[model samples]
Target chain A: MRNRLVVQLVDFDLAAEYRRLCELDGAVGAVVTFCGLVRDCEQQAPIDSLTLQHYPGMTEASLGDIVASADRRWPLHGITIIHRVGELLPRDQIVFVGVASGHRAAAFQAADYLMDYLKTRAMFWKNVAHGGERQWVDCKDSDRQAAHRWSQDPKRQ
Target chain B: MIKLLFFGRLGDATYAAPEVFEASVGLTAAGVRDALSSLYPALGRALFEPQVLVSVDRVIVDWQQPLLDGCELAFLPPVTGG
Candidate 1:
């Protein structure tokens, strides 16, 4: 019935989030979704706690831009992009972006597109300070590989 | 001159971002990186090359752009999203 884009930085609430995404998809004949949560371990590093950073104004703009990109490409009934910021403990919800569309294909594509751009383009950054001494996690090459797959022209093998 | 900011571990790694910098009037984010490299010789090893991410006014800049006055520039490591 409607289209929406939601982005936020809270302690992260799961049950409420499921409700929010659920509420937005009344028109969708089919809805496919995903949720990303914080794990106890990261890249062989013990992440006792995490603090997410973002450029406030820029963060919202980046979200809007991604939403716009999706709008430009496909027709979807609803969209939800909620990413957590601030100090987060292990097992906390790191981020989630769910899309609802008329069919399975659009929903899946929208969700994948959102995640790809979020990794490459979002202004948000993560800092993992271990219990003993804090360490800043580096952006991994794998993320680049994942994001690169969405480029306009994929390298022909 | 370009004024840059820092955050999180990226800030800690650079001993925190410089409050201000006297940079060339019009330069790209690449120029900002070079300026920071020259200014903070201590970070030459960790910050040089094309690995650093630069932001203008909090938005990451795709290199090959010009810097503006009072623009807040940022040097970020490859991002692990927040």
Candidate 2:
């Protein structure tokens, strides 16, 4: 039942987050974490910076819902999701998803599900600055497909 | 009053500041879109584009969704965050 959901303009500490998840329960045997980083290049062009925009109230609510859904689907000891907003340079951490469970299978799958849903369901947008031009990033078809796969067989894993 | 929010590209295309208007009875989400569209044609095209989502009070709803006083209506482009 130890769950942490945060949306902030500042960065998060992965080590501290991992330790928190580790101490969630004595039964926790596996911890899975995923961190998304800003890339240095988009397509073939070098990028200057990336700006993340999000609906303040809606973004937090959406993250809460995604975490709740993951909790229902798995027997997790803890879950942590932190997403950063505002301007960020290349290689900056953009998102972090961590799940702790009694077993590796549950922990791994829950973390994966959390990320897939976050990419599509969360109300956050990314805009990239490249060559002095800025543009909003578009949702990828592959990401849609990845999220769709989870719905296809909910009972699996 | 109904508060309208535009995010991402929509915010850039239109006003970044939240727009507020007096909420009249029988007003629907589509009505607001039409009202804004007539005033901003370029934004109107973007609003009509595929994948643009409309949310009322933080929840996604159809265009026919009715508005309530003091509700927050947000127009969101397809989200790309990880």
Q: Which candidate leads in lDDT?
A: 2
lDDT tens per residue, model 1, B17-70:
577777566678776666667867765445664667667887777876787777
Docking class of 1: medium
Q: Cα RMSD to native, each candidate? A: 3.5, 1.7
TM-score of each: 0.81, 0.94
Standalone chain B TM-score for every prediction: 0.68, 0.89
Per-residue accuracy of model 1 over A17-133 as CA lDDT, tens digit each = 556656774666656666777778777877788878877777788888987888777787777777888878888777877777778787888788788778877777787777666
Model 1 misplaced stretches (Cα beyond 4 Å):
A1-7, A22-26, A152-157, B13-16, B23-31, B62-66
RMSD over all Cα atoms, model 2: 1.7
For candidate 2, write residues B1-82 as lDDT tens digits. 9988888899984443448967999999889888878878788888888799899988999999999999999998989888
Tell me which residue pairs clash in candidate 2. none
List residue ranges in candidate 2 displaced over 4 A: A154-157, B13-18
Q: All models, DockQ values?
A: 0.55, 0.87
Window of ten residues with lowest summed lDDT in model 2 chain B? B13-22
Lowest-lDDT window of 10 residues in candidate 2 chain A? A148-157
